[model samples]
Target: MAAKRKSNKKTRKKKKQLIPPAFIVGGIFFVMVLLIILAVINIKVKNLEKDIKLEQSKFNYARQIEKDIKAIFYDLEIDKSFAKHELIKENKKILLKYYLKLNKNEVDTLFYNIGNLLKKEKFKISYFSENELSAENEFIKIVFKVSRFKKSANKTNKEMYLKNKNNNHRLSIIIDDCGNNINLAKKLASIPYPITMSVIPFLKYSKETVKIAKQHNKTVFLHLPMQPKTYPNTDPGKGAIFLNTPKSLIEIIIRKDVEDLGFIEGANNHMGSALTENREKMQQVLNALKKYTDTFIDSHTSTKTVAYNVCKSLKMKCGMNRKFIDNVDDKNYIREKLYEVLSLFEKYNTIIIIGHLKENTIQVLKEELPHLQQKGIKITNIKEVLN
Candidate 1:
């Protein structure tokens, strides 16, 4: 019995060493709490991801609306009537406004076309009035406004049409030797006409003259210097390309003169009476000029000049002055030349006239330009004349 009791005590000790019921219950509860925490964290993460995706979708939708609107405008052909497209920006949306100079029927057609485009894009659209066309979703919105063009109350349609028609006779005038005098060039530039200003390279005010002309929307030209028949006695002055100058040197000199101006649409000879007569020399000059400005206007200093023919062969723009109005520098002669040039308009649509920057010439121009403008003789530029 004593032995049996000792054995029973050992067995009880072994049982105590095994896990307790309270500890098992506590372990199961702890595991359940950890699982609940993990499940809560996972739910919050999934919700955040869904919110981010929804925001990205909204952003993409907004971008798509912009692209769709751009496409709609790109497909439509614009004319003089669609004057202005003004954009007004709100916090996160854009209001597209167009001030159309169109008739009521045209405005209606434009709105109708835009509505059709948005309908295809699956956007819900509504017309606030005949004037407003808009499409909206929860994330993006685009609006287009239309209005019938308003004409000036002062002028009738017939009068405006006639006025436009009368302003047809175009004369391109080139004022030469411009860089010699700053004030004189200023006066020439201030004539309120788009005359071509020809500046002699390396003159005291060459760059300034070019700048002033450009400021006034005038065409600028490099008055290139070249050897004349009386070269030794009558210097063509600085930057003159002589007959003896190698083709490579001639090109370099022409490039410098052109690059110096920074903005000359064309070039004309200062005095190339001898140089122009030589085909090989003129070819070299034209070849050099072709690299800079393909357009060349013969001062018509020498009738033997092959500049025009060379330009034609090269497929370059070419023009020639019909007359040098201020050659004599007499006011009366200049006046007569003006009338003569004006008379040529009867036979030709365009004529080019060349003149010097003289006080008498400036005075004549100031006195006559307004009258010429009144008679619908608009002074154009060399590019227009060449065209």
Candidate 2:
């Protein structure tokens, strides 16, 4: 019986050893679970990095696209109303793609901006549609209309202008210093009215400016540069059409300046402080101008210019600049100049005012010109004033 008791105790000790091995197995399983959890965490961190990189790239691309869109809208606004439809449509496509790819709120804002920009360009929105997609986003479809002017001023003589039924006064604005800026010249050309363009001769852009002016059916004139007191240190251009130049030379220069720009109905002096003061020089210029059956206008840099005398002698159409709109380069000054022109018109029944291609001058003209008719004022071109 003593031997049987000892054997049972040894068997219990063996069972205790088996329990230790089970505990070892459980520790190994715990280590494996820890390794699996670590691997999952690494994979999740790498995925997050990739998502961030992709989003950053998308953001950069969207910013660049937005820049391009804004530039296009600026062109449509500053460029002429006669802008190419294809170009506008192409830009619209790019804008649409970028806006659609953005979130819904961003897309709506883009369309709203576009609409506002178009309104400033004198265009009216016809209709718009938006579609919601599965990405919880929407895309906009925009349609716009360009408003038309009824009886927008074309070229008119005094009689024809007086007979027009449109209430807007006939102010024939002639913009000078045009040849160097083709885009701006073209923009001016597209104004539908008979605004004359006075291009400086021999500029790199002169031919193109003339072509654009012709395309818009606007009159083209040579902004002839005479010897001005302010420009004593500089020559105007090659073969400068100064009043002091000989009659034969003047004719040759004028002919060359008008080279294929089409028929030049008239001309205006650019700066003629020296040329206008010399009666002999004025006579030479007048003689040369007589060949083309065209009119002449003096910029009137000097009050003593012989331009009126020459014009009267030749029986040719003659006009003089009454006011310098942008000489002081202030809005109030320009407005005062315009008001002075209206006052002069009231007194003389016809008057001409000279203006340069400054932004302030354009802005003032746009604001003030529409109200001239209500004040019983008539705005006519230099020719009408002469006749």
Candidate 3:
């Protein structure tokens, strides 16, 4: 019994010595390190969240600036030919250098209008002059230079130039989503304007609409469906290209779509808010387009789109949608959109406006096209756009 009791005491002592002091210290140190790592990861996660929010906010501000610029140009009646934009990237911010050609009166009007607009938008005017205007906010910076308007050297050229200034503005009206509605197509065909019809594949009357448009002397564009940002749920419909789709698969998809459209003169994205942002995917898409069609237009659904850059790199002639007309099905909204279209001519030597082939859209065009023609906006075909 005495031996057993001694053994129990020794066992207790052994149990107490089992964990060395160094081991205890090491365990505490390891726990502290783990906690520090966790804290750092938590902080990084929060920072990432803040970054995402900031990016979204910046995108919103950029869109607002685009609208403000559009409104300003329209109000000033500045010719698009005289206004140009050069993008500069620095420290993750895009600086836009606006080259403007304006008369003294327009310059005066610009300052008065822009000064008020910037102030309302919480921007500070960094610099102001008769020839230059600069403004900045947290997310945006604006600088525009007004150059002297060039005059024709000879009297004959000057006279001719004045006579055809409006005609020089090339406008292409692309009627999108055409295949589903043959009656609308029929109505559009009867219209005198050289309308360009962009038909989506796998629609009820895909080939039939193409035939109709061709018969009516209309230019056809393959309305290439693509994955929008809200994909999987939004579903860009049949024959749409997804970002995850392999390059080889994209080529096959595009080829089949092109062949299905039955000789498209040009192509444009149907709903490519997501796919246009992927540079590699866009390169593949544009290459496929280069095989069958000469021209492509970025649908401009997403501001982050690299489609235009990719298209230029591939040397494929391309354009982008300046604005979407008739997004709302209302006649008044469309009329307002068309009214805005008139002002675009002053800024763009060539631009294409996209609209759906709905009944209301057709009606609005028929009513407003005559007025546009009267005002010297030439309603030309898509081929003329690249020219």
Candidate 4:
């Protein structure tokens, strides 16, 4: 019986050892499976992140392409207007060349859209070419040469009509108060259009403004200061010719003003409300301007201006401002004023528009001047307008 009990205990011990080994093997298998599953999941997450990044990059590229297309469209609109006026009204041939760094599809789209726009505007396309260019680097070069057929009419009548029409319509723009800032004057002069720069005499930048105006082939005028209705409260600045200035003194001041402001083609009152209304005062100023061969422009500061009559009596070449562009210093308002000038152009066939060196005025001119040129409006100097 003692030996039977000992054998049973040994059997129990063996059973316990065998049970532990089985549990250990199962735990090791579970850990291996978990590690393999985690490795697989990590690889999938990495692939998903890369795909998201790629998709984001593609979206950004598409947005940039859209923006570029819109910009190209706007530029084409301006070019089309210019081409139409030159070809249809002026009977001139225009060759426009554009270089763009764009992909093949974008280039093709640009040409197609331009062609359609021009066709819609009744413009006959005389020449068109597009190809990949390698100057400096790879870019797309597009050339468009356009013209219009002249109407069949009696040659004599046609010549007479055209001659009269050309002679009648003229527009002059004068930018005043230019001597205060030389940099602004330089920027205004750099514009590739005929505009008159009326610099205030004896201002801080008066000489520098004239120098830059001449350098850029811009016409310069003396923005002579005269007393305004507001009087001392609205001072026109130093060297102003007031209403109370004596006739002799006025003549001396006028001549000195012209002499000091070298390279000026004409003189226009700066703020001559009171002086312009005083006939005698205005006559003295206009008479002085005659000796210098400098034309006079009545700024028309006062509705009761006698400067115009004085100029006529003195036989001085003169013009009057029909519109002031930046009275409100608002873009929309200035634009409306410009359109008013255009309307005046239709009726009078000649108009002079004056604007200050304000930022809004410059912005409007930079944007709309090209459009004005596109509409067959001539931007001329004060001399041409007066003639």
Best by lDDT: 3
- Which sections of candidate 2 miss by over 4 Å? 1-171, 260-262
- 122-237 per-residue lDDT for model 3 (tens digits): 77667644366677787778888878655346444324434446777767888888899888889988888888899999899999999998898898899999986544434677
The alpha-carbon root-mean-square deviation between model 3 and the true structure, to one decimal in Å, is 15.4
| Model 4 segments more than 4 A misplaced | 1-168
| Per-prediction backbone clash count | 0, 1, 5, 0
Model 2, 208-273: lDDT tens digits are 888888888777787776775433333455546665567778888767766644457788876665
Q: For each candidate, what TM-score against the reference?
A: 0.56, 0.53, 0.58, 0.56
Measured with C-alpha atoms, the lDDT of residue 261 in candidate 3 is 75
Q: How does each model score on lDDT?
A: 0.72, 0.58, 0.76, 0.66
Candidate 1, clashing residue pairs? Answer: none
Quote the lDDT for 145 in model 4: 35
Of candidates 4 and 1, the better by lDDT:
1
